[model samples]
Target: MTIGIALLTLLHILIPIYWLGGDLGAFYSSTFMTDPKRTVGERMMALKILNNIDMAPRTTLILAFPTGFALAWAKGWLAVPGFAVVIAAVAFLGWLALAWAVHLNHGGGAGIKRLDIAIRYGVLIALALTGIAGVAGDVAIPFFIALKLCIMACCIGLGLIVRRQLVPLFGAIRTMTSTGPTAETDAIIAAVNGRARISVLTLWALVLIASFLGIATPV
Candidate 1:
């Protein structure tokens, strides 16, 4: 393989590694952050660390599509033009910038967060449709690649669900910090965390399936 293709392949391979590994770290850190035995200050510190570590997976998710698209184009798997890939890459970069802007601001702006949510939903729908079309032979996408797209769509959907679930958790955390953790607030945190745990585990499973499909493409 040419150096460019090899590099693209390397990036495609590395993204999932960081995504899964970072997710594991974030999950464990969350346990510490949510532990009632921990001091409020200690929990907040762990939360900060969790947010920082979460950027890896967040960034990788944004990169995954464009990298995979470009790699597929290079490998003659995609029939799209080179310029189409360029356009897609530029668009992904814009999305990445928007995502980081929201993250770095700690989700301060409601308007920007809405925009981010809209973008994610749009991408999720697009991925699901494309995967279905490809698998149905309405598009030329390889079966494994098409399946990966569907997997990505599922991942994004779960991520959105987790994001929604965390809204109350964040509020509960603020309450705990200010009021020293009432039973109601602790219950809120526990309930939200429980819901989020299931979603996260499913997401991890989907990522593993996608990784396996990438490695062991079926006939």
Candidate 2:
């Protein structure tokens, strides 16, 4: 591989490693934050840590798309023109900036939030359809790449679901902070955590499988 391809491959490998690993850390911190036995102050600290750690996975997920495509093009696995690669990079960087902007906005940027949601679902649906079409031979890409697309789509889809679920979960946390924990709050917290865990672990499985496909090209 040329230096560029080598670097792309290294990035492709590292993004998922950090994504999954950082999510695992965030997951652990979330458990502590949700635990009823912990003092409210301690749980609040865990929440702070969890929010910070979560950015790793979120950023990685946004980045994986362009990086994956660039690697494929670099390796001659995909027949795309040079300008397309630049377009992909521009789109990725733009989305990355929007992601951080939304993060820093913290729900204040209603318009920015809507734009982010549109981009998220747009990519998700595009990948899902790409996978389906490729699997059905409606597209010309390799099967392993198609599978990777599908798996990546599934991961993002699950994460979106968990994001929606978090509205109530975060609300419950606020209530607990002001009114102290009640049985209702504890149950909501536990239930939300339980549901999120299942989706997140499913996402991990998809990420692992997709990473293997990218490396092994198992067809």
True lDDT of residue 79, candidate 2: 87
Error of 2 at 3 (Å): 1.1
How many pairs collide in each candidate, listed in order? 0, 0
Steric clash count of candidate 2 = 0
TM-score of each: 0.97, 0.96
Model 2 pairs whose backbones collide:
none
Tell me the lDDT of model 2 at 206: 84
In model 1, which residue pairs have backbone atoms overlapping below 3 Å?
Answer: none
lDDT per model vs. reference: 0.91, 0.89
